[model samples]
Target: MPFKASGRATDYRAIDRFDGGAGWIAHPEETMQRASHVLRASGGEADGGAWVVDPVNADGVDDLLAEFGDVRGVVVLMDRHARDAAAVADRHDVPVYVPSFVDPDVDAQTQPLGGTLPDSDYEVVRTVDWPGWDEAALSDGETLVVGDAVGTTEYFRAGGERVGVHPLLRVKPPRALRQFRPERILTGHGEGVLTDATRALQDALDGARRNAPEVWLNGLKALV
Candidate 1:
């Protein structure tokens, strides 16, 4: 499993294209399989604009974003996920938005995320605020975008889950996410869960602790 260091991706594979927008996995062949998402949202003074979340740059991504609308801002949900955020924000001449509690080492100018995103209906939800891990989620009831609290990747899920809590957090799943009953769940890793998303999220959180052993065993099997 090659670790994708924080920088521009050499190539990427697009996935999870939906009505709102699309997502892509940088270095898709890598085992970690980090995925980034974008959403076309509107509110307040703006009509429609694309908000890139935890992005990893690759060819044709700009064109993909263009299909949605103008790039409004780049959002970093987790403190450690500054992957290509500054680069993408700089390219679009927008500021990188992060939660006020986090202070990532990106070069671009940043704004504290709160309330609803400027000109968009997406609301930020504080998911985790631990010593080393800080994360936030975005939602508008129908679509939910998460950082590291949960994911759909092989590393994140157990045997029967469409989405699963992160291995480290499974023992104590983030309670804040239970409030959302989204029709689609977009994650910062792996592909989004497009169908049965609400049930998937509920199951993931409700079963996280009980399934921790299974998840651990599955990880061991993969390593073997």
Candidate 2:
């Protein structure tokens, strides 16, 4: 589907709240909302009440909300710096939990999904996934928020290889799942949501990388 936060024009205003929001990513990809992330506050009573922080480009975030409603528990599938997810947590006043590889400052954070959120201003809650925490499963929505691990700009990369050409739509490597069967994927840059061509690519990549161990090893190797 075309980018739309429920038909709302791509909103740069939401991008202004993060650490160096709009200007943080100065690369050419940055011009098109690269490195930007998706802010998702968790909901429902059965699951943790925290939010999901997937760093997607402007269009991805917008279309994601439109397709699946607000996110309620952050799931970071990559280790790339996710545009200061803590700031996003603070914006919604929720806890931020990211993958361990994300290199976050968990000492300053907490779990937002749980109601025990401290009275103090929002801090980070870096979950540092030692085991797989499919927080997205908590939501009735099938949408998964995978920071930069999933969608990204056309030519966005640090070393000189754009991930679009890489085997998987992944970055910062070291993956766990052999394939991501997200009904809808919100990329941080380039085309935000994946439904048609992007969806087909996701399926193909998932099938090729069924060797979870090798896929993760390759991803980590690429980053290292």
> For this target, which candidate reaches the highest TM-score against the unseen true structure?
1
lDDT of 1 by residue, 1-224 (tens): 66444556777788889878789997786666788987886742235888999998897789778877889899999988898899999999999998887677789999888867666668888899788998888888888999888888777888899999998898888889889999999999889999989999999999999999988776666455
Report the alpha-carbon TM-score of model 1 versus the true structure: 0.93
* Range of the 10 consecutive residues with the lowest summed lDDT in candidate 1: 38-47
153: Cα error in model 2, Å: 1.8
RMSD of each: 2.1, 11.2
Each model's backbone clash number: 0, 25
Candidate 1 structure lDDT = 0.85
- Top-scoring candidate (lDDT): 1
Which whole-number lDDT from 0 to 100 does residue 135 have in model 2?
19
TM-score of each: 0.93, 0.42
Task: Let me know the TM-score candidate 2 reaches against the reference structure.
Answer: 0.42
